[model samples]
Target chain A: MTDLEAGREALLDHVEALIAQRGGVSITLAELAAAAGMSPANLYRFFENKEALYEAVAERWFAPKVRAMEEVLASDLPIRQKFYAFYARRLGMICDDYARDPALFRSYLELGQQHIEIVRGFIDLADHFLAELIAEAIAEGYFPGLEIDSAVSLVNLMLQTFCDPELVVMLIHSVSEEKLAIVVDTIFDGLRGDRPSNVRRLTRAAR
Target chain B: MTDLEAGREALLDHVEALIAQRGGVSITLAELAAAAGMSPANLYRFFENKEALYEAVAERWFAPKVRAMEEVLASDLPIRQKFYAFYARRLGMICDDYARDPALFRSYLELGQQHIEIVRGFIDLADHFLAELIAEAIAEGYFPGLEIDSAVSLVNLMLQTFCDPELVVMLIHSVSEEKLAIVVDTIFDGLRGDRPSNVRRLTRAAR
Candidate 1:
């Protein structure tokens, strides 16, 4: 990498360490520069402002996760196994972030609508990977009659607790692997097409 | 009602109005007492502390929702329709709470683990109703092999985004009714039984 890029990566290491130490992003630019043995002015050359720095931090934290999800999508595993691995990985990483520094993770999440600009690219990338999987599944004759985009949106919507960072922290403790399996199983059932004929007949008889 | 109950209800009315006006629950006991045209000492007779007051508020808000869900469960609608109505009513009420006052709703939600004591009974009541519906579905031979508690827990876990107060506020906007329908449909398929034979054959062929 170029010297400038190397310098930025090194600086980000210090920033992440300090954030983990403080359990938040409340550390100032000057503090970060001091931790890196540099002047605030030098830090400014790398990151224009605190938000810019945070944007980098968010990107650095988020990009690898997107790549990992993409890797899962590209794997030759059974489609059902791939779906479980994809979400389990996503949930595990976010839960790790929350466990590592809840305050810092929460600040990033609590940025809500305001911080969308910083992380929108990462979000879209991840969603694109998810869409790719859904499209593949549709092509393979799963989720028959469902439009790809709508099906993708619906799956993402249902999986929000597993994917939305804030929900992950609040609700993850209760989410066991068994529960995750059940949910994924349900999604598979839903995507595999209409309700089973036996089920429909039973419902009709009951009614 | 008894005089004491009448007076307490009147006091709660003032508290609710002040909470709405301020967009939070930060109003002091003295302020609430003044708003109710009573001395703080008299207010103490109604609510021993802020936590107690908030508990009453939570109960008042939550009890009706539980009752509403029970009504849905009792209705002669098809099991599938009952499922949709049950969750739609829940998502609707929480979203309404958020729309009316985001700050107050957030404070209540942010109370997190600490606030469980006040809300646990209400939560259990709601879960009971959910379990009842799931048990009914199972009894009708849907989810033929699943245990009732596991089925109910899995369904609840999957629906956390709709039911978890904090997630509801963060995610409610993106959740269209069509999306909710898709999720409920998926859950129905999941609950109704194993993979369809045709889909199984298709998947095996794709492999």
Candidate 2:
């Protein structure tokens, strides 16, 4: 990586440390720059403003999960195994991140909400993965008769506790890694066309 | 109710209004009493302190849901129907409450964490109901060989987005009433032991 890139990441690390210490992102830009041994003008050159810096921090923290998800989605594993592996990796990373610096993680979620665009890419990426998987599941005769959009919505909603940052922070303690696997397995059960033939499907029938 | 009980309920309503206006419970006892046209000493007669008032509000907000869950548990409906009705009522109430006053709901969640004991009773009550339902599901051969505790954890983890105050607030927008039903139906799919009898069960075998 370039030295400039390394310097920017180092600045983010400092900002994250400040947020963790104060339990929020209440530090001023000048204070952040000073703490990183840089002038305010120098920091501004890297990040247009505090919001920009926060956005960068959020993107940095989430980039790895996005990359990992992409790798999982691209692997040769079956769709069902891909689904399990996808969420298992996410749950583990989020839990570890939360456990390490809960305040920073909380700040990251608040930052995401304050600047929705900051998290939009990640949300859209996950949505894309979920939609693709649902389509594959249907093509494979699983979740038969379920429309892709509705299936995406259902699976996304079911996985929110594990995937949504705000929900993950709230539920991380109760939802251990084992519990996440079970929840994923349960969702797979739903998607596997295993409901008794007698149980009427409540969702709209696919064309 | 006695005249004193009426006065106390009125006080709680006033406190809730203050919290809504401030988007938090930052009002002083004097302010709360002044708003209610009462002396601080009189307010003290009702609640010991700010924490006590917050706890009361938390209890008042959660009371109906708990009562509704109890009714569902006691009703003669099938175990599956009871589960659906239970979460449906909870989802509706929480959504309505969140819509009516987002700030107050946020404050309630913050208060819940600041004072865990305030929410302990509600958690224990729900855990009890979940355990009971899982036992019944087992007795009915729904999730045959699944232990009650594991079943309860799995179901509760799956339902966190709908039931946990913090998670519900985070996800209430994406998870509509229709969506919650679909998710619950998905969970019921998991519990029904319809995994084709070929898939190996990952959970402990019920003795």
Candidate 3:
């Protein structure tokens, strides 16, 4: 990467750490400038305002998440494995990122009209990727005779359930990682055309 | 209902309407009392404080939603129908309630710990109902050879998607009722055991 690109990334890292510590409420451009060892005027050369910096931070945080899914989508893995890996990676990234800096999560949630459309555009991109993946899976008989639209919606629902701020807050407070994994597995098992035999074994054990 | 019950219900209704109009930030007990043709001191007999009154108003609004789901669960409708009806009712209630009072939705989103617990309890109840319905559906061969736990999780995921605040906010702003209905229907179809022919028709139309 170019020196300027490296500097931009370093600035974003500093901003994310600060935002996480402050819960996205009290961020000031001066503080960010100081943290990045740059003058406020110099910082403005990179970002117009605090909000622009925030948008950059959000973009930086979400880029890896989208890239991870793209990697899974492009892999030669079976459709079920591809879908599961994509979602699991997404969920794990979110959980790990939130654990490292919950303020970033809070900031994303607080994004208003200025960023909402941009965020929605990214979401639409993800949705399109997912829809195509589902279509390909069904066409290849990896999932038997699945309806494309419903499958897309189901995947969207699954993503929402795992990423829901309220549910995630509660789950992180009281739920174990093992249990969360099981829940994710169960959700995918329902979505997939074929069920693993161990699913029955696990169900019986739970009972 | 008894006269006291009737009077209490009337007071709660007045308070809800006032809060709806005033965005829950400006409504005062005195104003509510005046609207109900009672003294502010008399209003105190019905609610201990503003928070308590707000909780009561929320309870009054949500009680029917709970009742409707409970009734569906208890009724003899097919599992698919029961699931569809439950979610349809839930989405409708959320949309209608938000239309009447956006503050009510905001308040619920910002609910304190005690209220969060109440909301969680409601979610757990719905989860249990979904589990039961899925179990029955599997037993009836609606989903032949289905994994029950996974199916239950998927159902929960579907329900959660409908109520996810972030997604709801986006949909409310950008989607029509017809589009929302399609979203709901597609999700349920995805969860259904077999691919329905109508999915292709819908997908083509959407394209």
Candidate 4:
């Protein structure tokens, strides 16, 4: 990478480190500059302010996960397996992230709400993929009555405790993948097709 | 009623009116006293502090609702209708309350979070009734594999958006009974006995 790209990389890394260490987005620009051994002016050259910097961090850190989820949706796995795979990856990653630095994950969530537009963009991306998956599930027989958007709404509502950052923070101590799996299973059961003979899709194509 | 009792009742009504008018729980005890034609010390004679007064409001305003839910639970209404009645009452009341005074409802949630013990007690009461309703559904045929607690967990998770006080505040402008009914129906469809012929309950008494 060029010298400018390298500097940008270092700045972003410092931003993450500072948020993790400070437990919130309340950290000062000066503190961030100090963490990176750079001047505030240099940081300003890279980002207009904290919101801009956070946007960049989200792009670097969270965007790839959304892309990966899209790939999961496009995979050759059955519908159930595709969902299970997506859940497993996310559940593991969130648990590990929380275990490594509980405060940082929380700070990220608080920052997302504070910078809601950036966060909503990220959520919309995730929602797009889930909407596709929900559509396929409906075609396959589950949620016979729901259109894609309504099904997505149900998923959002059902998983609010785990998916919502603020709610996650409130219930983190009691959260577990086992419990989450049960929830997923229950929703799928409820969504299961009541009429198998009318199934539209021949295979649960991942793609 | 005795004069002292009458005075306390008047003070509580004024508290509610002030909160509705002020659009928040940030109203001062002194202001509440003035609204009620009493001094702060006189207000203290009825209740020790603001939290205590809020607790009283919760008892008078909220506890009766919880008891009413219990009555619904014990009623011979179909499992589905019991869930429906509970959902309808809560969704209607919340929408009306939020529409009437958004800030007070938000402040109520904040206070509940701050005074978690009181909130927890309230939640437990609600959950106890939901648990019984879920158990009856399971015994009657729906949710074949779910135990009472697990089914209640799903109910809590699924209805969280429409039911959570804080979440309701966040979504109040967008909320409608139609959308809420969709959610309630979706959950009931999922909870509808997978094996209908084995249904044990026959009555769906409204009372």
Candidate 5:
């Protein structure tokens, strides 16, 4: 990377740490610059204001999510596996972000409708990709035929579950990557047109 | 109702209306009393303080939700339908509250962990009910055998979609009882062990 790019990345990292620790209130451009071994004036050259700096921080975290979705969609994985991989990767992104710095996650949540709309657009992109995959899978007889709308709705529902604040808090108290995987698998099973072999095991266990 | 009961109900209604209209900040004992056609001093006879009154208001709204879950669990409906009804009712409560006063909903979100934990407890209650229902349904041959833990996680995931702020916001923009019903039906269909006939219709329509 270029020197300027390295400095920009360092500034973002410093800002993310500060935001995670202090939420939205604690960080200032001067502090961020000082942390990066630079001056406030130099920081100003990079970002116009606190909002710009914060937006850049969000973009840095969000870009990877967009890329991950794109890669999953472009991959040759079966529809069901693709869906599971998508949710697993997405949830991992959220869990990691919350663990690293919750304030950045909070910042993303507090973003204006415009920013949310952008995020939603990306979600829609992911949803459309999944919908297409499901349709193709059904056509190929790899999965039982199912309604695309309900399938998309199910995918969206699972995604929302990963994003729930209360669930995040609960997970914090009992953090388990395995449990998260089970949650993902269960959702996929519930959404599928056919039951997995473990369905009987689950039912018997329930009884 | 007795005079005291009637008066207290009136007072609570006014508090709800005011909080819904102007938010938590706009509420005051004097204003609530005035709106309720009672004296501020008389209002204190029924409640300790504003916080107490707010809690009462929440209880008034929340108790019915608990009762609804009980009714769903006790009813003879299939486990999948019961789960759908439970969440659909919960979503209805949120939408009703949001419609009555956006500020009140905002207050609930802003009040931090105490409020959020209360909400989570309600969801946990629902989860327990669902876990039992799934167990019973499986035992009775209503569903294909499934892992109890995985089923509960899936149910929780599907339920969370109804309460997700982002998804709720999206729904509001295109709000309709019909649309909500469709969404709810889609969810139930997705959850059912047997695929619905309309799955093909949904798939084609979504694309």
Candidate 6:
């Protein structure tokens, strides 16, 4: 990378470390510069303002998560196993963030909506990955008599409590480890229910 | 009611109307007095400050809803039908609030957390009602092979997106009429899945 590019990247890294320590409030140019062992004026050379700096920090925060999730989606594991592994990784990441720095994680999530477009992009990207898995699950005859669209939204609702940082931060205590596993199981059971082997639930839609 | 009691009730009623008209911002002593055809000093006879007045307003807002919900819970409708009716009523009320006064609804929800104890109490009450239906559904052979505790939280997760005003405000368009019905169907199908007729998904907890 060019010197300027490297300096910009280093600045983003420093900002993230600071946020992990102090949440969103510490992103002032002076603090970031101090964290980087430089003057605020020098930091200004790399970024225009706090918002620009925050945008970069957000992209950095989301990069590895997106990559890991995409990897899980693209794998050839049986659909059920794939879904379990994906959420396991996601739940682990959230717990680690909260444990490592509860204050930062909470405040960041509270203010996270300020980066709405970025967060939306991540959710959209994750949704696209999950959509692929849902299609495969249906094709495998796992979700019999279910429309793909409905299944997609159902998965979104089922996973929202686990995946949304804002909700996670809010209900972190209420959603326990055992509860997560059980909800995942229920969703899978519901997805895989009503084959020739299981009892049939008369469709309310049909009624 | 005594003459003073009648005056207090009138202020609370006036406060609700104004909040529904202008949101939490309208609860200021001056605006409330102006809205109620009384002096600001006289208003202090009833409420100490905005916070106190808001707590009362919040309670008043939740009381009838809670009563109606308790009535729904007390009814002997079959579990499946009961669940549907409760959410339908809740969703309809929320949609009406959003439609009737989008600004007030938004502001109220934004400041809604200020009355955290009252809101939490309402949620706990509603949860108690839903818990009974969940237990009944399990007993009625509707949710075959599902744990009660897990089922309760699953029900909460499933209904949260559809009912949370904050989420509704954020994802109102994303959750369309057709999708809501379909998701509700999926939950039911999953509930009824894995009976003697279907090959049961072995409990993951066992594994």
- Best candidate according to DockQ: 1
Share of native interface contacts recovered by each model: 0.39, 0.33, 0.13, 0.21, 0.15, 0.19
Better of 2 and 5 by TM-score: 2
TM-score per prediction, in order, is 0.84, 0.83, 0.72, 0.81, 0.70, 0.81
Q: Which tens-of-lDDT digit does each residue in B63-176 have in candidate 2?
A: 899899889889877666667777878888988988987877897777567778778887898899878877887888776556788778777767777787676787666777
TM-score between model 4 and native: 0.81
A best-first ranking of the candidates according to their lDDT comes to 2, 1, 6, 4, 3, 5
Provide the overall lDDT of each model, using Cα atoms, as 2-decimal numbers: 0.73, 0.73, 0.62, 0.68, 0.60, 0.71
Can you tell me which runs of candidate 3 are displaced by over 4 Å? A26-31, A48-52, A111-114, A142-151, A163-207, B24-37, B48-52, B98-114, B131-135, B138-154, B163-207
Error of 4 at A65 (Å): 3.4
What CAPRI-style quality would you assign to candidate 2?
acceptable
Query: B1-207 in candidate 5: lDDT tens per residue?
Result: 888777778787777677566654536677887888877787888877867776676667678877887887887665545655666566777778778767667755554234565556655776787788778756766444447665566555545556544356445644333334333343343444333223333324434
Report the error of model 4 at residue A24, Å. 2.8
Provide the lowest-lDDT 10-residue window in model 6 chain B: B197-206
What does candidate 4's lDDT look like per residue over A1-207, in tens digits?
Answer: 987778878888887887777665566678888888888998888777877777787787675577678777888766765665565456556666667877778888777767788878977888888888888878788777667886787677767676665766676665555556555555666553333311112111211
List model 1 lDDT by residue over B1-207, tens digit each. Answer: 998888878887887777656654366788988898888888999899988877877777787687779788878977876777788777888888778877767755654445677778777787888889988887777776777777776777777767767666766667754566667777776654344333334335656
Which ranges in model 1 have alpha carbons more than 4 Å from their true place?
Answer: A96-116, A192-207, B96-116, B192-207
Error of 6 at B151 (Å): 2.7
Q: What's the C-alpha lDDT at position A63 in model 3?
A: 88
Q: What digit string (tens of lDDT, one per residue) describes model 6 on residues B3-40?
A: 87788789988876776676556457888899899988
Error of 4 at B207 (Å): 52
DockQ values for all predictions? 0.36, 0.31, 0.12, 0.19, 0.14, 0.26
Write candidate 5's Cα lDDT for A84-131 as tens digits: 556656667767877766656665555523355545555567677778
Give the candidates in order of DockQ, highest first.
Answer: 1, 2, 6, 4, 5, 3
> Who is ahead in lDDT, 3 or 6?
6
Pairs that clash in candidate 3: none
Runs off by more than 4 Å, candidate 4: A20-22, A25-31, A173-175, A192-207, B1-5, B17-37, B49-51, B173-207
